[model samples]
Target: MKFAIISVTEQGHKLAKNLLEYLENDPSVIKVDVYHKNVNSTLNKCFEEYDCWVGIMASGIMVRSVCPLIKTKFTDPAVLVIGENGKHVISLLSGHMGGANHFAVKLAGMIGAVPVITTATDLAGKMGLDTLAYQYWLELDHRISIKNINQNIAAGGKVDLYLPTKFDFLKNHPIVNTSYKIDIWNKTFIQASFSGDEIVLTPRRMVAGVGSKKGVTEEQVFFALRSALQHLHLPLSRLDAIATADIKEDEEGIKLAAIKSDLPLMIKSLEEIRNFQHPDCTTSQLVKREFGVGGVSEPAALIEAGDNSRLILKKTAYNGVTVAVAVAI
Candidate 1:
């Protein structure tokens, strides 16, 4: 995770430096930028850029400084406050979704400091719905009443938890089993819509397989992918990965499109795509002649999405690009 450390005082700078030293050696930490001066300007500049912000200052000062920039927890970065003496590390904001509370505890353990977590679920010895969503890489509908559901869980009240069969293992979690009344429903996360005022965590299980002619622009590929998803009435965020045949590994346009979409580019071998038996896979004589495969997009998507997967959208060609979408069973 990327981190930004803001320190207003010399003593706080020292603490920030110490924290940086600890974080730099950790393999999990991707990047860390330290700001020992111009606290206000630095906070404004780095707040949205980094995954988390560590303020080495007083709690009141940190809170007041971030108050103006604070937005919804879904998009905000995790915020933490650590005293100059490094005696305590407090999870100040975005405790659940942004992972401030979990990181605070981990940071405190690293530096031999006390971690102060004030979130209700953590205090009640129960995992919050937001935390579960963050930890398991599940997407929550921001429109839902998450606060009320978490409050219910903390109050020893049971909340309905819906899960696909693939995620049945989560039922074994001690807190989840106790706090939620789970129903195993085998369907897409979006298809299994909420039955009542309960928590619904959508698993990111869709893969978009792409096929494009050489020298095609990233815009063409991206537009094709977006168009295919739009046809299904799904958002771009619902896609988990962009898949293509291994022969097109050097195709910069497809690669750039995947990068621009912020999704992983999964390459499936030609043999895998050819051997796969899917009735919906389009028969392309040109593709068979060029790459020895009947199709690229449909089978590649189905292969990357794994076993028991089904094509949600069949191959749709746009300009020189072809796009298909598949969902894991």
Candidate 2:
């Protein structure tokens, strides 16, 4: 995981620097960038660049900068604030719902600091749907549904699992309606709904692709993907991965578009593309010439494995730009 460490004071700067060194040596942390000036502004930039933030400053400024992001629904990153003196580490934002509490405890253990966990639901040792959503990167489309599910679980009902792997952590979880069998590959939303209290365990549906003509604007790509998903009756939250050719790897417009969508853009190499095979494929020559790659691996994967096979959304925007949406088959 990548983390941005922001600090504005001398003590904060030293602490941030130490934390950076510690995190750099930790395998769990892929990258850690330390900024010792302009805490709020730097934090905003970090929020744009990184998945999470670690603030080695007072709670007041941390709260001030984070409140607006959460209030505006502006893709807030997981936030953890630590005192300069190393007295306390608090998961102030996101908490259990956003994985902040879990991160805080891990970081605190690494730094020998006290983790100040304050989420009531977690303290009570009950199942937290929001936390589960964060773990799987699922967008909680219906908070009422979660509330109702949790209520049922709390009332001694069982919750079912549709995931491929068994989650032993959830075996004795206090808030599961019941445990039922669900095959991740073959189950439909309607079928899963009828299989007793159920939550689908497939990958998220926020992933999208943008095959653009030369010099296409980011807004155009975004609009095309959104329109395509809407046309297919698919929510953006179900996406799990975005795919494109290696040529678009450094395209700022394409990269930012994926980030804005909360989707990881996987740039496939030519060899990887050549490995794909599909009988009904239609874009062979176009994929090779435009993408500078051999096959449409992403579209093929989406088609063969997508949940809503009957509702594939494919569209070409301005010029030769194209976008495709499919659930895991």
| Number of the top TM-score candidate | 1
Q: Each candidate's TM vs. the true structure?
A: 0.62, 0.53
> What's model 2's overall lDDT?
0.59
**Candidate 2 lDDT, 100-128, residue by residue in tens:** 88789878987899999876555655555
Q: List residue ranges in candidate 1 displaced over 4 A.
A: 142-144, 190-195, 205-265, 268-329
> For model 2, where is the 10-residue window of minimal lDDT?
186-195
lDDT of 1 by residue, 1-329 (tens): 57898898899998888889988765335467898867777888768988789998888988888999989888899999999888999999999999899789878987899999998888998887788776655677754577777788898887777676656766777877776777778675622223365445677578988888888988998888888876554557568899999888888989999898889999999888878997556688998888888889889998998887767677778999988887775
Give me the overall lDDT of model 1. 0.80
Clash count, candidate 1: 0
By TM-score, how accurate is candidate 2?
Answer: 0.53
How many angstroms is residue 257 displaced in model 2 relative to the true structure, after the best TM-score fit?
A: 36
